[model samples]
Target chain A: MNLRKLFAGAAVAAVALPVIAVSAPAGELTIPSLVYRTGPYAPNGIPFANGYADYWNLLNERDGGIEGSKINLIECETAYNTQQGVECYESTKGEGAGALVYQPLSTGITYQLIPKASADKIPVFSMGYGRTSAANGKVFEWIFNFPATYWDGATAIVQYIGDREGGMDKLKGKKLALVYHNSAYGKEPIRTLEVMAEKYGYELMLLPVDHPGQEQKATWLQVRRERPDWVMMWGWGVMNQVAIKEAASIRYPMDRFIGVWWSASENDVLPAGAGADGYLAAAVHAPGADFPVHADILKHLYDKNKGAGERDRVGEVLYNRGLAAAMWTSEAIRTAMKMHNTKDPTAAQVRDGFENLKVSEARLKELGLEGFTYGIEISCANHSGPGRAAIQQWDAKAKKWSIVSKFYDRMPEITGPLIEADSSAYAKENNITARSCN
Target chain B: MGGEFLFFIETTISGLMAGVMYALVALGFVLIFKASGIFNFAQGVLALFAGLTLVGLMEKFGLPPWAAIIATVGVMIVLAWLIERLVLQYLVNQDPIILFMSTIGLAYVLEGLGDIMWGSDVKVLEIGIPQGAVDWLLDDYGLYIEKLEIVAAVTGAIMVTGLAVFFNKTRIGRALRAVADDHQAALSVGISLRTIWVIVWSVSGIVALVAGVMWGSKSGVQFSLSLIALKALPVLILGGFTSIPGAIVGGLIIGVGEKWAEIYIGSLVGGAIENWFAYVLALGFLLFRPQGLFGERIIERV
Candidate 1:
């Protein structure tokens, strides 16, 4: 009789284990942040990860959770490697409330995750950087690169140059050099730049620097020889700093030398000292910690000693970018709940919410991000919101970046056709039908 | 000369300066290989560690530059003694492959310890090294040369001369040469092989620190400073592993050869050929002369 009783208890325990493993905790939204706090890119990755974690913490602490459903933020270290990022996504995607959304923060990992996330019915918010073609929502139903994309950045750069060179007509016969990291991320904007070059009649000089670009003596020597009218950089990590320093070494005009968004940061310029003064970079949002959202973060997180990183580095450019990404993510979650009429919406419902998401100027002010960035509205037809960018100059003496130009409008005439062609090719390859907005 | 010919000359001069930097790193490797018969793969990380320590001492502890440098040197000496006592003592008489693998593990340990000590954020290593293009060079001959590179070249020359004098004239240098020839024979002669290993590693540590300071100043002190080891590898292969002069000659050849290839040959294949051009040159050289330009030729009987 005792043996039979024991066997019955064991059988019940065995049946409950798998059920417990599969089920998410009730009334909690789990958002897994794949971060890199180690490795070569840690200097840049740490602040971004910290800003992301702090924003979520601010939402949970100050607001008592978004609509009373507390957020369970889980951080997994990826070290900025794509393989590790995929593993992080696989391990954390099914935890607590089924992972409402994902922000891979890496283009290589985003490319790897686009199909997986689509099949899993999860929304991917690549924010500003990813496959620019994913902006066409007809094919990329689950992927969103709101605010801007790399191709948009390239167009904005060209537009800014056109404005500086007197006019689009004045761009003819001008030599522009591109010193880019040799990677998919660096190569993404080439075709768009080539198209713009053809239309504008500017000579494009392409220079590729291998990964972990510490040595640029040869590349800069070529830059010296060519004597291009303007130099543009598509660089990241140590590459940006080294390129800036090398340019400074060669007495390249700081004002004319521009960098894509990733290449422009306090981390990049601070190392180059006074030589980095007047360095220009394309920006998607205003820099510095003056926003009201920063105050709320300080009150809710840093004041309570729960801040994710150094308190002094709270409002720097990359930190603010991370905060902006988290804001969009949380707002999307709120939108999902409101549309579904349920506090605990699954990842698929959140994807639906993303497809119809809109954040206006009023909403931006309400969220304490007034004048921080432009409004974003993601829809079925458009995954990239507005695709506007501005130029910012690094003032090394002041140790800050200030907006030096108005937002350059996204050139849809050029980018639209490119996006359509690429997304159509991708759709055909994957056998995916383009979905209609209506 | 035509404008294009002048540009080629300017590129060659720049390439030669870059080669001198690579040779500085290779010099550290040659020192350890000569005395200890170990490749000392951690030489690059040792440079990084030294830079991190020097920067940490100055920034965190607020030591004066001179005091911080001296303290860093002391730290390297202690590290050398510790490595000898802890790692080399246990691994003595091991196969060359095993010793090489141990140094790789040591590299990782040093790298982690460096990050933990200095924090991972890139720090400006301003040791008062003058930077920017030399005005005189640019104006006189239309040749652009960085002041920092000229300083590095002068420093490298001084270091090489000092090393040559020490190795040829000192009694300790003789002892080190005896140990390099035969460990058992050195022990029989009561030269203390272990002491010679510690001294040799300490000297290598000093060389690494010098290379680190130069590189850390050129670029910020960061993790990538350790990658100079990869650059030094082809130098070691070209200049026989045991020859100091060979390292210098090999570095210049690889550097100038790669630059010329990237400029002239790289365009045919869409540029960026400097990355692999050096390794290919070294490989081609090895096919013809298995014993490098300066490496001691080895003969064996079955």
Candidate 2:
């Protein structure tokens, strides 16, 4: 009787093991998106979050997920606060297939998650923001800020100004002002700009605006008195709108005023009305919702009444940026699958894939974003891809932004050394051994 | 020397214009505190709600600008009545801190409701307020002044005069002042405390609407509209919480002082001193005058 009972218990256990395995499928990929859907920055955050979610949803509906492995996309709200962002990261990192990658969408949060992500063997994609020196993959293997860094942006803006001034030599004696937010994200470009100033013999004036910068009467008053040749801004949220309005109030030439990518959006331009007509900003992707991928999104998501945000805002600049980030994430997952010959890859495997990823022009066309953005390539030694950017001008009359310049080459001569120096310093401070990538 | 003097003058004029808007928000706090003896901390959220309602009514219902303004004003009055009935009435005779804390909770509720009603997009409040710099001023004095700011200054002056008249000349206003002075004595003389509280809240709501229009017209109507309350706190601290005239004088002092500090002293310290200059000035002033610039002095009897 005891022998019979033992055999029966073993048979029942075997049956239950298969059921549990089926319920928690091994071939599922989980991506955790730390979003700020409600906060002072919600106007900017909501569209980006919607776009990110929509792109993934389109993939699930159209292609049945990446390489036949269903994607489990989980969103956690951080309200644009760093502490909440870390909490969101910790809580959601253990869900489902266990967060293959994290996109914090905030520099402050990305800074906090850098060490934590390395320890957890999960890759972090700060995209266009965060610590600019994280471009040096030797010290920051788990972090990726591709397309461009703040230093790259600062150099590109200087190049654009040089082009307008006839040549790089003409930049000498030119006075340029930088109106930036008073935070780590805002101060990222100061050192780069200063280096450029010393090299080109131009004067760089720095103006720091307090957070949520609604009041800029004094700052612009200084602008009027000094009358810098060009005013470049690194503002976010309400700060961008107020600066533009104040710039207009001072009768400053709008064409000469350029803002960083964060300040270049319809929400920023609309507040200042027609006075923002000639305002220019740095952009990593083309603006508007005219891409073929947008049509797929509309048909699969909005048309079926499953859209995440306003249907009209589907192709806005920031929306397209979010879509671009989601595409990069999906491509990296595909690379992991191809590289490891596995239906589902671990977080560490995904990091390996991100290191070896390349999104060519042909791939973008196939993905229906042919002209939506420039091609991006990442590797073991370099994390910030190609570091190219374009200048976009807001057409106040049309209520949209248009790319105004061809892609400017990334100034690796200026940024490369800075990244090496900063990253090396960080490595020594933290007792981290720099990795050798062959 | 000429350029420096001209720049200083330009900064002062611009600072005064900005100060008027701060005073408008501070006046809302003074009105409620004087009549009800409750420091209504939700004044800034009230402005945000008022702006959101105006914009929402215009956009969602397709109402014309004037019609939207009227409808929004009606909504604010109804909101005041609801607050008096649902919140204030229940918590009567509570500690002032309790009342202040209740308003803070109300601010959160109103802020959440505003976002839900209007959607969380930054909206342009275009009631046809003039934008762009005044060309003549720019040509004559090389001074750039936003025309919209000039309109805001004039509007603020008119609103302050109207409020001053309403507070001093009307029978209900006189009774409201009586309640502010001594609630028990006013009640004994047949003045209704509930009626006075409701009236004061409604008046403050109107002041909030004016501020909303001015500020919403300046910047966009968004979450930052609620943050303007933080800006008004320094103004209140400088002017005294219960004085309307004090609110305006305090606002000018802070606005001008900070602008000057940012221009002259800011560069020495790497420029962005406007944020803390106002608070520092208020703190320094408070050390000298414990009752504020115009607050009623308290004499304790042991």
Highest-DockQ candidate: 2
Q: lDDT score, residue A34, model 2?
A: 86
> Relative to the unseen true structure, what is the C-alpha lDDT of residue A355 in candidate 2, on a scale of 0 to 100?
91
TM-score of chain B of each: 0.97, 0.98
**Model 1: per-residue Cα lDDT at residue A411:** 96
- Model 2: per-residue Cα lDDT over A107-160, one tens digit each: 999999999999999999999999888898989989999989999999999999
Lowest lDDT block of 10, candidate 2 chain A: A16-25
Task: For model 2, give the interface RMSD.
Answer: 1.0
Q: Give DockQ per model, in order.
A: 0.60, 0.64
> lDDT by residue for model 1 over A7-57, one digit each (tens)?
999999998886576565677898999888777788888888988999999
Residue A328 local lDDT, model 2: 95
Worst window of 10 by summed lDDT in candidate 2 chain B:
B140-149
Per-residue lDDT tens digits for candidate 1, residues B49-116, read 99989988999989988999999999999999999998998888899888889999999999899987
Q: What is the clash count for each candidate, in the order shown? A: 0, 1
Query: Which segments of model 1 are wrong by more than 4 Å?
Result: A1-24
